[model samples]
Target: MENYFLGLEAVHPSCLAKIITGDKLPKKAIIWEFTNEIKPIDLYCYLQVKYGSPNGLQNFLRNDSSDNLIHWEWSLAGQFGIVSIQGHNFRTEVHLIGEHDGKGLTLEDFIQQIKADFKNHGKSMKSVRVELEKWTRFLNPYHRINSVVAKNIKSLNSLDVKVDEDRELVKFHEENLPKLEENWKYVRDKYDNAIGITFGLRSMLPVLAESFINLIIFVLAKPEIKKNERLLQNTIRQQIDIRVQSLHLNCIGFTRPIDYTDDVCKKFHTLMNERNDLLHGNVEVNKLKIGEVYFKGKVPVFVGYEDMWQSAMGISLSSVKYNTIFDDHAVVTNFIEFILDHLSKDLKEQVQYIMTNSELGYNPANGRLGSLFSDNIADFRVSVNEA
Candidate 1:
């Protein structure tokens, strides 16, 4: 029921002049925009150190991820505002907007609070940079700028009043963001480990793609076989292919595979072949389109690097394109989604079904299938839900 508003914009020349003169404080206005080179995850962690809990702020801080950047707003009574945080990798941007209620500390005060607490968290003032800027203004009325800012502030609010006002979502996000942060940190540290070595992302990409593909196959197949059977079975990949064919078929609720049509089937087979080559063979980079590299096989064909990267990152290829060689996580993710629309359908039916029904969740037994299934599902679910 508590509502908060925050708006932020990059600093412009006019805003800089105002900041230098102290002509406008964050308290005088309803919104403040801050930019810093510091990571958004670090900032949120900083806020938790300063503010005690993730719940103290909006859902933006709780759900912002590499794939799912978040923005939010709220308004009630005389108070109105919005706050947003968006991050990609380590880079971050923030915006806050609202009506100034006389009861609390000003936005400037909050920024200073962030700066002071940031220091305790091993961040410097320069790293936790904050600024104020007006990104928009009403052209017709000069005197009504304040009124314009405050007017219909409720419209900016994104409480999702239609669905328990995001309580379940808020709880889910609060519980998972830190875990996501930790997982990404692990990945980042692993990546950083390669810094001193001769290894490049190009070679790593294929390995990552192979891992992702095997992971998906393993998750789809784990429930049907026991640990020993999983390891002992020589036909694990064949079994997984059959199950995936079934799941993909069942996902569309079709007697025969529909979405996994002939074209998709061909693509899937090709993708599997490419994954196999990357895992087992020497890959050759295309001289012209390094991004579209391949392994020499029965036939030489270029892999869809853009499609795989976009699929892995859950984003589209940028308008600007270039030739770069790398196997991508997107290929695996996109393939999974391509089959099931989202991993949720596959997990709820395949993985969660086993967990809820079979001995997997009942007994706290450690196994390769169980561990991989649980970890990957949890991670994928969080990412999908956040998305």
Candidate 2:
């Protein structure tokens, strides 16, 4: 059994100074020694080629999507010492492989599958010129998916509003918004600002996240096909990722069951963007201020804790089950069960083994009461004859 420590770190400026000699002096830095078994892909290099940073490393090979403009920051401890990487979309798979998928899917791999499918099956909106236009230049954009709200849109038809009339689409948006609005009351009335104050609301966050993931999966699921659904779905994924990252939020689980089409994904993304704006202190919309948070890019907005608590409860009602439970309180319990489900069966086995055998073995501080916890020592260990 082994213990994995996950915590923040403090860096010594003298140690970092040598590495960043020609660069700016370090003031506020979050540096740590990298000790994970898995090797890290150079995010700056990845971004320079993948995103085309205005100033990339010298003699670095350019990647296919060099036209993309993404920026973010990441740090690691290489063999030499500390490595700090700041740029956009510089993410490597924190998603462990073989948790749910025996073979984890990479963006490159997904793209290859789409290209193959396109070459073979094809879709209603396939064309060479369209193919060139539809390809992704960057995974992360500074403005984020929500930033494009100010972009040109000839009509909602492009957005797949499902209705022929523009007014009907707007009407539908107005009608469904009450759910998100009502949720605010549930969360805001409860906890004040605390680290985990909105932890429960993270579940609802995935509702939006999964919707976006569905869009990416939609594109990757297809072959070289250029379906109208492709870009729309990508929009959903892009918007959701940006929102999640911008809010500095994390998900408790990921469960999206969308068929994955471009148009469907776009619709959900659009809905989430509007919701984020209204919920995060936005005042432009009539009566929006009575309750809600407004989203301002680069400006961190925190939702009322009470609104999220209720949404968390609502999620439980929708998920979790043990003899078909009912009642509102049950929703939270079910949601907990659901978030635990985020750990795949394989990962759960790993966690269980680590918890029981490792030094960190179910810290008394974090586990359930000893009485409530099963005395499985004899069950999993020596099979004892009952006295």
Candidate 3:
């Protein structure tokens, strides 16, 4: 079993020395949860037992804060329990302590901080809470930035324009973007050095990046509805316009163009409402037995991968407003592959034109490219000519 220790930290060490941890209103505790089971010492000992290591449990009581550097001592663990600890700015602090020692940043300081808090609460300084599941699942809060960055990289890779065309979009958004990548190295270290568990780093980060870029495509393709941009705007009046445009079902453009045609638009209106129902909340599903009921078997099937994840966790996105920013990104990896497959054809030429010509403009969901990339857009690619 993996032993995980989550340390609570106040804003400053002076704040910690003054009072108790987790005792008052508005006292924010940033929990630093760490997991390890490799050493001879048990998890509980590392947490509750005091006096052996430099930052061992007892050292948090020292009235004087200054002391020689102890790798596993108060500096590392004592940061916690400071209810009013004040500082203008603070990074993870994981990087700032004892950085030169080859041991890497140890949890000793964090441990001492927690111990101090234990003392403040009038509780036994020799005890700590070590959770197995929460600590070891590998939910690295530290990785949040890097994961987002990886997504950005993938987003850039999926732009639907020729090399010269993509350069234009890059030139536009690159400068306007914010630098969200602060403390990106913590993520790098955890992925590189942490032990005892397998966490798939590439899973959601890549998907997030792709999904974001796809949403952008959908927004860009809004002006051109003939190709299925209507599938996205999917409102009643909008759907009808697309249907009429696609099938020329109604000569709305000419035949009595000015007259209100609710009759012609009814089917679209109903479907549009139904689509809203399905996308916005729980969808009722039932199975029918046709011809013969073979042995009366009963089983369950969850719809959509995201839906399944939600079901398992009792959390869902049905009511959440769809982010238009991510519309075309969902289909990018596939579309990029699609572009690769058609790189030698009329399609590729069209992409180059749409992407390169500032007048043409580029949309990830450009209907012309969507048809070719359809769904799976990542399988093919002979490096796009860079702008």
lDDT of 2 by residue, 7-71 (tens): 11223444434545634332222222222222232222332232233232311333433322223
Residue 324's lDDT within candidate 1 is 19
Candidate 1 clashes: the total is: 15
Local error of candidate 3 at residue 86 (angstroms) = 26
* Most accurate candidate by TM-score: 1
Task: Specify the highest-lDDT model's number.
Answer: 1
lDDT per residue, candidate 1, 1-387, as tens digits?
112321222233344335435633343333344446444545655544433333313343445432232332221112333333433232343333333445574555545545555655664333333221112211212112212222312222221122233223323365756665564454334323322111233233334333333434444544434345644244335443554555443232223343445454455555555545544654554411334455777665666544322432222112111121112324433554465443555464554343222122212244333311221122211111110
Off by more than 4 A, model 3: 1-71, 74-136, 140-160, 163-327, 330-387
lDDT of each: 0.36, 0.31, 0.31
The TM-score values for the models, in the order shown, are 0.25, 0.18, 0.17
Clashes of each: 15, 33, 33
In model 2, the Cα lDDT at residue 14 comes to 46
**By the lDDT metric, which is better: model 1 or model 2?**
1
Ordered from best to worst TM-score, the candidate numbers read 1, 2, 3
Q: Ten-residue segment with the worst summed lDDT in candidate 2?
A: 1-10
